[model samples]
Structures are given as structure tokens and as C-alpha cells.
Target chain A: EAGVVQSPRYKIIEKKQPVAFWCNPISGHNTLYWYLQNLGQGPELLIRYENEEAVDDSQLPKDRFSAERLKGVDSTLKIQPAELGDSAVYLCASSLQGQETQYFGPGTRLLVL
Target chain B: GIQVEQSPPDLILQEGANSTLRCNFSDSVNNLQWFHQNPWGQLINLFYIPSGTKQNGRLSATTVATERYSLLYISSSQTTDSGVYFCAVDEYGNKLVFGAGTILRVKS
Candidate 1:
């Protein structure tokens, strides 16, 4: 089966610009997650969705970052007026409900100048 | 929140050599996973070993849940095996806490 898919593998924007990343989870997977990875560091959870409900988003920066999984199969993470610190790799992963194994996409590399 | 620590932080090996990576966690966990992030930034699942041992080709992993530690073994390493290896644990069964990761460089 195909793995999780993400769009616009690489994006570049100036500081204070708006940017968005999209993700498509694997088939039949009921749990989707978004993570941010800085250089030389492991990924940190940003948001998680169980079906269409966001079960965890405490780590997300609500002031500038927002995410939604409307139909439950696809998700979009947005950053409005992104800051220079917002430059990082945005990764999307999915797994079957109740399963701990998660598969990740190639990730979207964002660079804010 | 739980703490995860990885040892060595970096490893360098020549082709055909073998090496081991270690991960130590601070609390009990329901799920543990090993992942390899390629130079292109794609995370590939290496193993989902919550307990016991599992082997796949040249790679193998063992997790001692009771001890709150895991080990990943790579045998006869190749240049392609060079990447960052991460150990992640889910204490509540949903959120994963990851270690800083071990950077591996296999020179051919």
C-alpha cells in the first residue's frame, strides 16, 4: 500500500508570510499527526487528529499556527505571518487506530528568510 | 512528560562493520519505535518493538520494557545505512516522545 503523502515537498517564504502544508494519510488509517523537526533534532508533535476530531493540539502555537482535518483523511497545517523561527521540516504521519506504528511522509521543508 | 536519552549521539563505521545504538527512557511506555531519517528528511520506520526482539535483514532491535531501554543493532553496515536513527516512546499510547537521535555515518 502507498504510504502517507504530503504536498509541496519544499517551500520558501519570507518572514511574516503565510504558508500552508497539506497531507494525505494512508488508506484505512484513522489517526493522523503533524510534527515539526528542527535541524539536528528529532521531531516534536504539533497536532494529532483522531478521525475528524483533534485529540491533541496542546503543542501547537495557536497564535500563528492552525490545523484541520475536515474529512478525516486529509489534513492541512497553516502558519499565518510565520516567523523566522518557523523554518523547519513539517512532517505528517498516520497509523491505524489503537496501533502504535506510524508511517511518515517525505515532509515539507519550509524556509523563512 | 517522559525523558528519552540516546547514547554516543554519533557513530562512524566503515562498510562491513557492525554497531549498536542505545535508548533509555524515564518512564513506563506502551509503545516504542525505531526510525531512520534519510538525508532527504524522510522518516522510515525501522521497527515497532515494544518488547522482546525483532530482526529484519541486516537490522535488528530489542526493547526491554521493564528496564525502559531499547537497543538497535546494525550488522555489516553499508553506506546506505548512514542516517539519523531515532527512538520514540508513547507513554499514553498516543503521543510520542523522541530522543535527540543517533547520527550514523557509514563510510564505504
Candidate 2:
């Protein structure tokens, strides 16, 4: 089976511009997560979705970051007025449930200047 | 939030050598997983071992939940193993916290 898929493997934008990343989890997976990974660091959870419901998103920057999972399937993460500090790898992962092993995508590498 | 720490931060090994990576968590966790992030930036799930031990090919992992730590062992290491290894834990089974990762370089 194909693994989780993410769009625009790389993205480059100027500071103050808007950027968006998309993710499609593995088939039959019910849980999806969005994580931000900085250079020399591991991924940090930004938002988690159980089907179409966002169960945990406290780590997400509400002012500039927003995410949505449509119809319990594909998801999109957006950063409005992107800042240089927002430059990082945005990874998407999926699991059968909360406790299952998560499979990750190739990730979208964002470079904000 | 639980804090995960991985050590020794960086390692360099010769091909066919053996090495062990350690991960420590600050609190109790219901799930723990080891992932290998390749040079191209793909995160590959290595093991979903929350406790006990498991082996696959030339790799193995042991997690002692009571001790709040896990160990990943790679034997007969190949150059393909070069990359960053990360350990992630979920205390409530809903959110995952990841360690900074151990950067490994295998020389042929």
C-alpha cells in the first residue's frame, strides 16, 4: 500500500506571504497529525485530527497557523503572513488510531526568507 | 507535555559495526516509536516498541517503560543506516512528543 502523501515537497516564500501545505494520509487510517520540524531537531506536533475533528491543536500558533481535515480525509495546513521563523519542514503522519504506529510522509520543506 | 531526550547527539561508525542509541522520556507514556529520518527527509517507522524487545533484520529495540527509557540497536550497520534516528512518545495516546534525534553517519 502507498504511504502517506504530501504535496509540494518543497516550498519557498518571502516573509509576510501566505503559504499552505497539504497532506493525504494512508488508506483506512483514521488519525492524522501535522508536525513542524526545525533544523537539528525532531518533529513537534502542531495539530492532531481524529477523522475530521481536531482533538489537539494547542501547540499550533492560532494567530498565523490554521489547519483543517476535510471529510475526515485529506488535510491542509496554512500559515498566513509567514515569517522567517516559520521556515522548517512540515511533516504529516497517520495511524489507525491514537495508539497505533504512525507512518509519516516525505514532508514539505518550507523556506521563508 | 512530556520531554524526550536522545543521546549521544551524534555518532560516526564504520560499516558492519554495531551501535546503540538511547531515548529517555520525562513521564509515563502509553506509546513509544522509533523512526529513521533519511538524508532525503523521509521519516521511516523503525519500531513501535513500548516495552520489552523486538528485532528486525539487523536492527533491534528495547523499551523499558518502567525505567522511562528505550534503546535502539543496529548491528552489522550498513551505510544506508546513516541519518537521524528519532524517538517519539505519547503519554495520553493522543499527542506525540519527539526527541531531538541522534545523528548517525556510517562510513564504508
Candidate 3:
């Protein structure tokens, strides 16, 4: 089976510009997650979706960051007026509902100048 | 929130050598996973061992849930094994808390 897929593997934008990343989960997977990874650090959860409902988004920056999984199979994470500090890798992962194992996609590398 | 710690922040080994990486958690967890992040930043699942041991080719992992620790072993390491190894734990089942990760560089 194909693994999770993400679009625009790399993105570059100027500070204060709007940017968006997309993710497509594996077939039959009901849980999807978005994470941010800084250089020399492990990934931190930004948002999590179970089907079409966002079960966890406490770590997400509500002021400038927003995410949605409209049809439940695909998700989009957006950053409005991106800041210089927003430069990092945005990763998407998926797994079966109630299952512990998660598979990750090749992440979108964002560079804000 | 739970704490996860990985030892030997970095390691360098010649090809054909063996090494082990360790991860210690602060509390009991329902799930534990090991991942290898390649140079291109793709996270490849290595193991989903919450307890007991599992092996796949030259790699193996063991998780002792009761002890709150896990170990990943790389046998006869290859240059392809060069990457960052991360250990993540889930206390509530969905949210994963990850360690800083161990950077491995295998020389050919």
C-alpha cells in the first residue's frame, strides 16, 4: 500500500506572506496528524484529526495557524502572515483509528525569509 | 505531559559495526515507536514496539513498558543507516511526545 502523501515538498515565502501545506493520508486510515520540526529537534504535534473532527489542536498557534480536514481523507495546514520563525519542516502522518502505529510523509520544508 | 530522553546525543561508527540507542520515558505509556529520519527529512517507521522485542533485518528494537525504557539495535550498520533516530511515546494514545533524537553517522 502507498504511504501518506504530501504536496509541495518544499515551500519558500517571505515573512508576512500566506502559505499552505497539504496532506493525503494512507488508504483506510482514519487518523491524521500535522507536526512541526525545527532544525536539530524532533517533531512536535501541531494538530490531530480523527476522521473529520479535530481531536487535538492545543499546540497549534491559533492566531496565525489554521488546519482543516474537510472530507477526512485529506488535510491542509495554513499559516497566515508567516513569520521568520515559522521556517521549519511541516510533516503529516496517518494511522488506523485507535491504532498506535503511524506512517509519515516526506514533509514540506518551509523557508520564510 | 510526559518526558522522553534519548541517550548518546550523537554517534559515529564505521560500516560493519554495531551500535545501540536508548530512550527513557518519565511515565507509563500505551505506545512507543522508533523512527529513522533520513537526510531528506522523511520519517521511516522502524518499530512500533510498546513491549517485548521485534526485529527487521539488521535492525531490532525492544521496549520495556513497565520500566519505561526502550532500546534500538543496529547490527552491522551500513552507510544508509546514517540518520537521526527518534523515540516517541504516547500516554493518551493519540498524541505522541518525542525525544530530541539520536544522530547517527555511519562511515563507509
Candidate 4:
């Protein structure tokens, strides 16, 4: 079976520039999540969505980071005016509705100069 | 909020040897998963043992949710096993709280 898929596996932008990452989850999966991982660290949850509704986004930085799963099958995570600290891997994962083992995609590595 | 702690922040083992990695959580969890982040930066799901024991090839995992701990055992390790291993838990939703991973390097 095809796992979660993410685009632009690597991105580099100047500080204060906006960047976006896209993800397409495995077929039939209903839960999607975005996570941020610094070097040598485990991923930290940024937001989680159940279908079209964002159920948990407390960890997301609203001022700069915004995410949407408009169609419920695919998701997009955006960072506006990204800072140097935002230079990290943006990971996308998916699972069955409610709760299930998540399958992750090859993350997009963002580098802000 | 939940706290997850992994033991032996770093481990080094020779090929064909055995090793154990542990995870301890601060509170009750509804689900638990083990992941291996390979050199290419892909998070590979190793096991989803919220409780009980499971084995796959040279690897096995046991989760004692009541005791708030889980263990991953690698038997006859190989150099390809090098990477970081992470433990994540969720109490309310699939959103996980992750622990700092344990870095393992298996040498030939």
C-alpha cells in the first residue's frame, strides 16, 4: 500500500519568506497531522485534523504557521515570513479516524537563510 | 500534557550483539507507538503495542501500560539498525507526545 506522500522534500528560503508544504495521505485514512522536528530531536506536533476539522492545534504558532485539510484527503501546511528557527523538517502523517498507528511520509526539510 | 522519557540517550553495539531500549511515560496513555528514524529521515513505524508483547524478526517490543513503561529488544543487531528510535503516546487523540529519541549505532 502507498504510504503518506509529501511534496517538495526539501525547501530553502530567505528569512521572512513564506513557504508551503503539501501532503497526500494514504487512501481511506481520515486523520492527518503535521509535526516539526529539529535536528537530532523527535517530532513535535504542530496540528492534527480529523477530516476537515482541526481537532488539535494548540502546538501550532498561529502567527506564522497555518494549516488546512480542506478536502480531508490532502493537507497543506504554510509558514508566512518564516524565521531562522523555522528551519527544520516538516513531517506529515496519517492514521485511521479517531486514533490509530500513524504512517509518516518523507518529510520536507525547510531551510531558512 | 504527558511526559515521555527514553533511556540510554545513546547506544553503541557491535553487530550480532543484543540490546534493549526503554521508554517510560509520566501518565496513563491510550495508545503507544515505537518509531525508527532511519538515516534518510523517514520515520518507520516499528510497533504499536499499547500493551502486551509482540515480536517481528530480530526485533520485539513489550509495553506494560499499567507500569507505564515499554521495552524494545534487538537481537543479533545489524549495522543497518543505526538511527534514532522514538516513543510516542496519545491520551486523547491520535496527536502524539514524543520523547527525545535514543540514538543507536550498530557497528560491524
Candidate 5:
């Protein structure tokens, strides 16, 4: 079976520009998550979706970050007016309903200058 | 919110050496996992052992839920095992709290 897939494995943008990352979870997985990982640190959850409904997004920076999981399969996370601190890896993961083992994608590395 | 801490932030070993990584959590949890972030930046799930012990190939992990700690054992390590190992736990079974991670380098 195919694992989770993400688009634009790498991206570079100037500060204040808008950027977006897309993700497609594994087949039949009903739970999806978006995480941000900085240099020398573990990933931190930004948002989580349960079949199109965002159940946990408290860690997301609503001031400039927004995410959507339409139809409950694919998800897109966007950052408006990107900042230097936003330069990091954006990872997408998915798991079966109520299952804790999450399968991750290759991830999108964004570099904001 | 729960806190996760990993000890020996960095470790270097020869290809044939063995090592143990530890992870400690502040609160009780029912969901715990170990992940390896490769040099190419892929997060690979190594184990989903919230309790008990599990072994796969040269790697084994044991989680003692009662003590709020987990151990990852890498025996006869290979150069390919160089990367950062992360331990994450979820108290509510949804959102995971991750440790700072342990960086390991296996020399050839």
C-alpha cells in the first residue's frame, strides 16, 4: 500500500510571502495531522483532523497559519505572510481510526528568507 | 499538558556497538511511540509500544507505563542507523507530546 504523500518536497520563499503545503494520507486512514519541526527539535503538532473535522488545533498560529481537510482525505496547510521562524519541515501523518501508529509522508521543507 | 524528556541528547558509537536511549514522561499515558527521523527528513515510526516489550531486527523497545519511562535498545548498530530518535506520547490518545529527541551517530 502506498504511504502518505506530500507535494513540493522543498519550497523557498521570501519573508512576507504566502506559502502552502499539501498532503494526501494513506488509504482508508481517517485521522490526519500536521506538524512542524524546527532544527534540532522534535515535531510539534499544529493541527489534527478527524474525517474533515478539526478536533485539535490549539497549537496552530491562527494569526498567520490556517489548515483545511476537505472531504476528509487530503489536507492543505497555508501560511500567510511567512516569517523567518516559519522555515522548517512541515510533516503530514495519518492513522486508522482510533489507532495510534501514525504513518508520515516525506515532508515539505520550507525556507523563508 | 505533559512533558517528555530524552537523556543523553547526543551519542556516537562504532558500527558494531550497542546503545540504549531513554525517554521519560511527566504524566501517565496510554499511547506512546518511538520515531526515527532519517538524514533525509522522513519520520519513520519505529515502535508503538505503550507498554511491554517489542523487538524488530536489531532494534528493541521496552515501555514501563508504571514508571513513566521507555527504553530503546540498538544492538550491533549500523552506520545506517545514524539519525535523531524521538519519543512521543499522547495522554488523550489524539495529540502527541514529543521529547526533544536523542541524536545518534554510528560511525563506519
Candidate 6:
């Protein structure tokens, strides 16, 4: 099966501008996830979806960051009025089940100037 | 929220050498996994071992769930092994908390 797919492998924007990232999970995978990884840091969970239902998003900065999985097969993560601190790599992953091994995609690297 | 810690934040080794990376969790978790992040930022799952030991080729991993720690062993390392190794865990749902990772550099 193909691995998770993400769009616009790299993005650059100015502060206060909005940026969006897209993700397409592997075929047959029921779980999707979005994570943010700052320079020199590991990926931190931003949101998790189980077939179109976002089950975990406590860590997400709701005021500026929002995510949606409309059809359960694809997802979109957006950052409004992006800040310098929001410059990071956004990663997407998928799994066959809730507790199964997760497969990740080549992250979308964002740079906010 | 859970806390995950990885050891030896940075490591350097010569080709044909061996190394071990570790991960420790602050609380009990039913799920644990190891992954390798390449320079391009793709995470490849290494192992999904909540307990016991598993060996694949020259790579091996052991997890002691009761103690909430895991070890990843690489034998006769190669330049291809140079990258960041990360450990992730989750309690109830599939949401995972990842460790900072162990950056390994294997020189030939």
C-alpha cells in the first residue's frame, strides 16, 4: 500500500499570513493524525481523527490552528495569522486501526518570515 | 498528557560499530513504537513493541512495559543509519506523544 501523502512539501509565508497543509492517508487506513515539529524538536501531536471524527485535539492551539477531516480520507490543517513560532514541519500519518502502527509521510516544511 | 524522554540526545559512531537508544515514559501506556526520521523528514516505523524483545536483521528492540522504558539496538551500523530515532506512546486513544529523539550519526 502507498504511504501517507502530503502536499506542498515546503511552504514559505510572512507573519500574519494564513497557511494551509493537506494530507491524504494511506488506502484502507482508518486513523489520521497531524503533528508539528519545530527545529531541533520532535513531532508534537496536533490533532487526531478516526474516520472523519476528530477524537483528540487538546494540544492544538485552537485560537490560531484549526484542522478538519471532512470525508475521513483526506485532511487539512490551517494556521491563521501565522506567527514566527508557527514555522515548523507539519507531518501527517495514518494507521490501520486506533492502536496499530502508524505510517508517516514526508512532512510539509513551513517557514514563516 | 504523557511525558516521554529519550537518552543520548546526540551520538556519533564509526561504521561497523554498535549502538543503543533508549526511551522512558512517565506513565503506563499500552502502546509504544520506534521510528526513524530521515533527513527529508519522513518517519519510518521501526517497531511497535509494547513489551518483550524483537529482532529484525541487525536491528533489535526491547520494551519493559512494567518499567515503562524501551531500548533500540543497532548492530554494525552503516552510514544509512544516520538520522533521528524517535519513540512515541499513547494511553487510551491513538493520539501519540513523541520523545525528542536520539540523533545518531554513523560515519564510514
DockQ of each: 0.91, 0.90, 0.92, 0.87, 0.91, 0.86
Which candidate model has the greater DockQ, 2 or 4? 2
- Tell how far residue A75 is off in model 3, in angstroms: 0.8
Better of 1 and 4 by TM-score: 1
lDDT of each: 0.95, 0.94, 0.96, 0.93, 0.96, 0.92
Candidate 2 differs from the real structure by a C-alpha RMSD in angstroms, to one decimal, of 0.9
Candidate 5 regions exceeding 4 Å error are none
lDDT of 2 by residue, A7-67 (tens): 9999999999999999999999989999999999999999999999999998999999999
Regions of model 4 farther than 4 Å from truth: none
Clashes found in each candidate (C-alpha, N, C closer than 3 A) = 0, 0, 0, 0, 0, 0
Chain B, TM-score, each prediction? Answer: 0.98, 0.98, 0.98, 0.98, 0.98, 0.98
Q: Is candidate 1 or candidate 4 better by lDDT?
A: 1
Instruction: Give residue B14's error in model 5 in angstroms.
Output: 0.3
lDDT string, candidate 3, B53-86, tens digits? 9999999999989889999999999999999999
Q: What is candidate 1's lDDT per residue for B1-108, written digit by digit as tens?
A: 899999879999999999999999999998899999988788999999989999999999999999999999999999999999999999894899999999999998
* TM-score: the better of candidates 5 and 6: 5
- lDDT of candidate 6 over A1-113, digit per residue (tens): 67899998999999999999999999989899999999888898889898999988998999999999988899999999899999899999998874569989999999999
Report the lDDT of model 3 for residue A55: 92
DockQ of predicted candidate 2? 0.90
Q: Given candidate 4, what's the lDDT at residue A56?
A: 92
Please give, as one word, the docking class of candidate 6. high
RMSD of each: 0.8, 0.9, 0.8, 0.9, 0.7, 1.0
Task: Name model 3 segments beyond 4 Å from true.
Answer: none
The DockQ-based CAPRI class assigned to model 1 is: high
Candidate 2 regions with alpha-carbon error over 4 angstroms: none
